[model samples]
Target: MIIYKEIEISIHNSIYVATKGLNYYLDKEVRVIIGNQQESDYVDVIKYIIDYIVENKPIVSKNQNIGYYSWLLQFRLEDINYYDLYEVKTDGTEFIKGCDTAISIIREQSEICSYYKLHPQFPSFNQMVVISKGVYEGKDIEAIRYESPEHMSGWWLITDDYDDDIKSLMTVHFHHVAFNRPDILKYLALPFGYRFLIDNNVIHVSKDDI
Candidate 1:
């Protein structure tokens, strides 16, 4: 059995929650930037988040940049603006050489480590509502790209038509999709304002009509 411990570290006025035992699992460590040094009460939250990620082994995609992968957390935590995650190299103790977000220690490019970054905005789910469904057949899963104000924009999976209410739609957060219908989670990282059609649980890219 593998066991891991989450530890708190401060560097350059930033507070990070990192793992001590994950190296055994992924040959690297996972570090999360909760907030600046002054933030508090994130230990338990970090522990829970890391545990969930390790246990579920959710889908991870490469970031637009090299040496990084998108490891997004499904649920939102209080006072945490960024839920996005990434992994980088480390000496197993210090931040990667020369880069001092102070996040990790640089190893050969092949080694893996984890970290987090901020997106322009995370879907607030408050102003988000599923506008329609049954837009696609055989899929039973209608996918909608949410285009709204900051913190309220991202992809929306419309599995059913729910009278267009925010409360009901909000319940369809990442967890639901990641758990019950993870086949569509691959589209989570797609850019905003792009609609996709699913046929028999398979995704195909189609040209947008001008």
Candidate 2:
């Protein structure tokens, strides 16, 4: 078992110092569920991803430049404006997916990560949802992209303007973004200075280890 993980940087092997953000969440675990019907519901893990990324993005190492991963996703609300109204929903501890804003980002990031075969610098669901050319659960779920202007501050809408609901399990399917599975996400490594940090899950290094 791993204790409080005291920045143990071994010189024998390539290792780097872990950041405070990665250190604190080492013991915690997060899970996400997608799609639902009847009441038209879907677990909003986007909010959770966004919040975690934003809070930790700054403390992360200099190599992990996650600035392009927009912290604040601006959107319209069917003509309604909620100036500073923030998300209040919760997924146990992190912010729940209010709508498609976060998911859209997730989809986009997943595509890029898949293309490059790399993981994100922040903790997120490593899953994929492609456009279903076939019909699912009686509805033509083309994979809701959450491209609407309305923002649900308290809860996430089940079916986005384009996506489908999980009325049944066989209705649709999702590809898990398990970049590093079988092992805890926090256990992933990253590069720091001339060395590499052991078990740096979120922050990924893009260049060669020098």
Candidate 3:
């Protein structure tokens, strides 16, 4: 599924407009244009594009026609009182083909930021643990307990309720961490309140909060 970030719409003229954003999944720019002489209201157009994006979640290819179903837009515009508008047109030079199966639009900050931030070469770490297990390498492991300076309690525990997709994503995320930040993994089995600082080829841990 493609997630678009920082999507914005702009008007070129009374009958020409476009929407643009970065496709988070592919790390590529995406733009879609619309043309209709009778449709000049930006608000209506913006709403239509928003609904289209949320429902279709389009993904794009380098060599593909960027055409969305005209009938779908027509059906949607009817609700906004599109009584005098012409038949929608998105083809040839008017369209910028390449969107498919884009499931969401993430504006501004995101859950984990850029996909490149998750790249193995980067110096980063997961801010929080979403899932944890009670055993590691067939040995029962005690939970690591830590409290932030803000007084929020944190710990890890075994969970089996995550769906398949979540499990797969988590597996990939951990593998990425393991590849570049193996040091973090070694400390994963460490005892409670073991805060560790990670830098390039550096490791520091504090036994007490300071």
Candidate 4:
């Protein structure tokens, strides 16, 4: 059996070293939270969430910086032959039908992890929710090009302009700002050097810190 403890150090170190720069640009009050959703027992559920986001998020098209949302349903419904999950007719259909399937799977997994005998040692469902919502919110931000940085780009969003209701619902959400490039995984794994700042700090605290 793969033990989480063995890999935790590497994961944590990678995250810290990757995102250290971006964290400097964020507000001092903003906090960072990192959870190993991909390492948990319910890895399938996490993969489903990633697939859902990939299928739904706006894709850059040739004509426009932002792709047409018209093709969203069609794209989502298209047969996803990329993974074994799609082997089961129910799998692809569930996500394609509506957001309900995605939500249900997440909820079920959350409950399973929550009530497991080793709950205290396992990652919490709330962490998954926080990360998911944060990623969704981050994707909505507009990408800005940086000339001096030699092809580097970044995403920026003003907190004040965000919908109050939506912002309220995202109480545990964290900010993510990184360039889209070959290093996308490095960025997504730990955007803005958030992990570094958290690690270097004497005491780290966030809305969800416990």
Best of the two (2, 4) by lDDT: 2
* lDDT of all predictions: 0.38, 0.26, 0.32, 0.23
Give the TM-score (vs. native) of candidate 4: 0.18
Clashes of each: 11, 12, 9, 4
lDDT of 1 by residue, 123-189 (tens): 3212333433432222456565555554344566665554576665543343334334434434444
lDDT of 2 at 165: 44
Report the C-alpha lDDT of model 3 over 24-136, residue by residue, as the tens digit: 33234323334322333333444455555556766533343222221112111222212112222222122222122111111111212332132111111233343333122
lDDT of predicted model 2: 0.26
Q: What overall lDDT, based on C-alpha atoms, would model 1 receive against the true structure?
A: 0.38
Which model scores highest in lDDT? 1
Task: Give the 10-residue window scoring lowest on summed lDDT in candidate 2.
Answer: 79-88
> Per-residue lDDT of 1-210 in model 2, one digit per residue for the tens?
111223221111211111223324332122222322211111223233335544564333211212113222221122111111122121212233233333444455455455556554322232222322222212212112222222211111121233354432231112121211212222211111211122323322244332
Q: Highest TM-score among the candidates is held by which one?
A: 1
- True-vs-predicted CA distance for residue 100, candidate 4, Å: 1.0
2 or 3, which is superior by lDDT?
A: 3
Q: Higher-lDDT candidate among 1 and 4?
A: 1
Q: How many clashing pairs in candidate 4?
A: 4
Candidate 4 minimal-lDDT segment of 10 residues: 65-74
